[model samples]
Target: MPVAIRLADWDTDRDAIRSIREAVFVQEQQVPVDLEWDDQEETSQHFLAYRETTPVATGRLTQGGKIGRMAVQKSSRGCGIGARLLQAICERAKEQNFQQVHLHAQQHAEGFYLQAGFEVEGDVFYEAGIPHIKMVRSLI
Candidate 1:
């Protein structure tokens, strides 16, 4: 199925965004709720991927050029929805005149971002009990 990607409004799309994140990060991954929700949502540029009418994945690009909170439902993994979401976020960063964009990718998913042109920048560290590494991609 073709996934549709779009810029999401935090006000109207918060529920959909939270559902995906909660399912993946909270329930499945055991990330603390406090660590999952942050003050950045209103200021960040959010992207949502939908398979037909149902949202399957989501991510956000902060005003500071950091991409985070990426989540794709387990049933939807390996279908390329995540890459599509990342591309949309990167394009949005370019539109906002950001020279580069970075993300804290979970260690296991580093290869996914690497294939998308992001470079591993530092040693792996733990966030919310999961290993993560900083990765950056230049857009200029």
Candidate 2:
């Protein structure tokens, strides 16, 4: 199914964004609740992907040009929802004049970011008890 992706307003879309992140990160991945949320919500540009009317995926681009908090519902994986979301986020970054965008991807998902034109930048590190690697994609 084709998913609809759009830039989300944090105040209006907070519930849907929180639901998807809590489901994928806190529940499934066992990431601590404290680590899953941050003050960035108010400042970052958020992206949400929906299947019809149901929210299926989410991601965000921060004011500092960092991409993070990406999550796709378990039932919606491999459906290209993530790629579309990333594209939308990247386009937004370019529109905002960001030189490059970077993300700390979960190790297993490194290949996903790689396929989206991101290159691994450093050694593995732990975040929220999960191994992750830094990846960057130039918007120039």
Candidate 3:
């Protein structure tokens, strides 16, 4: 099924976005609650992927040239929901005239961002006890 992706309101869509992230990041991946809900949500531009009004995925782009907090419901994996979320966030970065977009991709998710045109950079590091690598994509 096709998913509808749109810019999310920080206040209005916060709960739905948080629910999806909490499921994938906190519950599934074991990322800590403190680390998952970093106070940046209010500062970043968030996007949500919905299937007939049910929120299925989410991602966010920061004005500081970073993309983070990406998550898709466990039941919605392998259905292109994550890609849709990433694409929406990248489009928003382009609209904001950013020349490049960067994200600290979890090691397991490196291939996903690579397929989306991001190139791995730097050595691996740990964030919230999970290994991560920096990845970047040119929006030009």
In candidate 2, residue 45 scores what lDDT?
93
Clashes of each: 0, 0, 0
Ranking by lDDT: 1, 2, 3
Model 3 root mean square deviation, Cα atoms: 0.9
* lDDT by residue for model 3 (18-123), tens: 8998899899889889888877888989889998889998888987979998888888899888987898898889989999999999999999999999999999
Once superposed on the true structure, which residue ranges of model 1 sit more than 4 Å away at CA? none
What is the lDDT of every predicted structure here? 0.95, 0.94, 0.91
Global local distance difference test of model 1: 0.95
Better of 2 and 3 by lDDT: 2
lDDT of 1 by residue, 1-140 (tens): 98999999999999999999999999999999999999998999888999999999999999899999999999999988999899999998998899999999999999999999999998999999899999999999
Task: Please give each candidate's TM-score.
Answer: 0.98, 0.98, 0.96
Clashing pairs in 1: none
Poorest 10 consecutive residues by lDDT, candidate 3: 32-41
Mind giving the per-residue lDDT tens digits that candidate 2 earns over 78-112? 87888888989999999999999999999999989
